[model samples]
Target: MNWIILIIAGLFETGFATCLGKAQETEGRESLYWWFGFGSCLFVSMFLMYKSISGENAIPIGTAYAVWTGIGAVGGVLAGIFIFSEPATFWRIFFVITLIASVVGLKAVSS
Candidate 1:
């Protein structure tokens, strides 16, 4: 259950980061929404990560964190492309897949 919460929190870290990126493009009141959302997610993620680390040793915690971040990065890029319509090129997709695979491989080895 703790690990699950940690993973969820880590995903939220990506969410906040992506929200920050989106907020940067906007102006005035609408930007506030994104900024607030980003901050809230950031806080929650950190708290959850702290809980994870407290529950587990450094190695597993670190490995899980790295994997989570990698997943988040891929998710963020996809969200940007689809939600923001930033860009969606073949190379980008390839890199994202590579990153995902690398994370999975790391998790497998660590486990």
Candidate 2:
């Protein structure tokens, strides 16, 4: 359950990143709304992270943080490609896949 929370946190991290990107590309009320979304997602992500690391089943901070950022990084890259229409270059995809594998590897080796 802690692991699940961590994953959700990471997804919210991605949400914040996406919102920031969208905010950058807009203006007026729309941009303000995106900024609001960014703040909300950031808050949720941080709260979930704290929950994942603070209880009886708490994940080790080192491993949990790595996985959290790894998931966020991968999701951000994919979102950039699909949602923001950023480059889908070979190296970008390659690194993203490796990041995913590393995240899985971290999870596999943890308690």
Candidate 3:
């Protein structure tokens, strides 16, 4: 359950990043709206992360954080490619795959 919450929080991290990117490409009220989205996602993401570390058998902070940022980083790159049409080069995709493996490995070894 904590892992699920962690994953959701990481996804919200992606949401905030994507919103910030959207905000960058807009202006005036439109940009403000994106910023609002960014803020909302940020809050939710942070709150979830905090929640994930609670309870008796909470995840070690180091592992939890690494997984959280791992998900966020991978999601960010994918968002940049799909949503923002950033480059989908070989090396980028390769690294993304490796990062995903690393994140999953972190989960597999964690208890």
Candidate 4:
């Protein structure tokens, strides 16, 4: 399903974002791994985004893009807290929840 593929793309968006952070944190052979990881994830994310927006599903471009970025933003924040030990402030969690709700709302209203 297109929705499923969109969700996968969003997850890959999260992957690339987190990998980017890891890549920035160090240098040399280990950083190379993160860079490669970021590249692979970015490729898949874009590929799936294309699939979801094109062909039969034909979701509106703006809608698809918003949902994709919404997922990435929320997932990235969670990853920052859990994986990177970033502060888990109340306002941050509240906004993340709202973003998630918006993503779901878009999906529910879509054809």
Candidate 5:
């Protein structure tokens, strides 16, 4: 259950980050919506992270956190390119793959 929460938190981390990018492009009334969405996701992610760490030891928690961060970062980059017209390059994909592999390795060793 805790692990599930942690995973959900990770997904929310991605959501908040993507919302932040979108919010940056807005100005008036619409900006408030994006800001509020980002804030809510951020708060939830942090709360879930706290719950997850409390339920697990530091090593596993930390491992899960690192993987979650990797997922968020990669997901953010992809979102930026697809949704915001940011550049998508082979190098970017390569780095994302590397990050994913690192996450997998971290999880394997920690488990």
Candidate 6:
């Protein structure tokens, strides 16, 4: 359950990152919506992550933080390509796969 919560929190990290990108692309008042979305995601993501790493079942901080950011980095890149039409070059895909492997490896070895 903690792991699941951690993963979900990581996904929300992706959400906030994408929202930031969206906000950057907007102009003036139009960016407010994206900003609001970013803030919402940020809060939820951080709260969930904090919960996952807190209390008795708390994950090791180093491992937890790495996995959280790894998910966010990979998810953000995928979102950039799929949602924002960013380039899907060979190197990008390769790195993404590598990141996924690393994250999964960390998860597998964690417990």
Listed per candidate, the RMSD to the true structure in angstroms reads: 2.1, 0.6, 0.7, 0.7, 1.8, 1.0
Model 1, global lDDT: 0.80
In candidate 3, which residue ranges exceed 4 Å CA deviation?
A: none
TM-score of each: 0.83, 0.98, 0.97, 0.97, 0.87, 0.94
What C-alpha lDDT values do all the predictions have? 0.80, 0.95, 0.95, 0.95, 0.82, 0.94
List, in order, the clash count of every candidate structure: 0, 0, 0, 0, 0, 0
Tens-digit per-residue lDDT, 4-93, candidate 4? 899899999999999999999979999999999999999999999999999986888999999999999998999999989999999999
Candidate 6 per-residue C-alpha lDDT over 38-95 given as tens digits, one digit per residue, 9 for 90 to 100: 9999999999999989987888888899999999999999999998999999999999
Backbone clash pairs for candidate 3 read none
Model 4 C-alpha lDDT versus the unseen true structure: 0.95
Best by TM-score: 2
Q: TM-score order of candidates, best first?
A: 2, 4, 3, 6, 5, 1
Candidate 4: C-alpha RMSD to true structure equals 0.7
Model 1 TM-score on a 0 to 1 scale: 0.83
Best of the candidates, lDDT:
2
Model 6 accuracy (lDDT, Cα): 0.94
Q: Which residue segments of model 6 deviate by more than 4 Å?
A: none
Residue 49 in model 4: lDDT: 97
RMSD of 6: 1.0
lDDT of 2 by residue, 1-111 (tens): 999999999999999999999999999999999999999999999999999999899999999999999988998999999999999999999999999999999999999
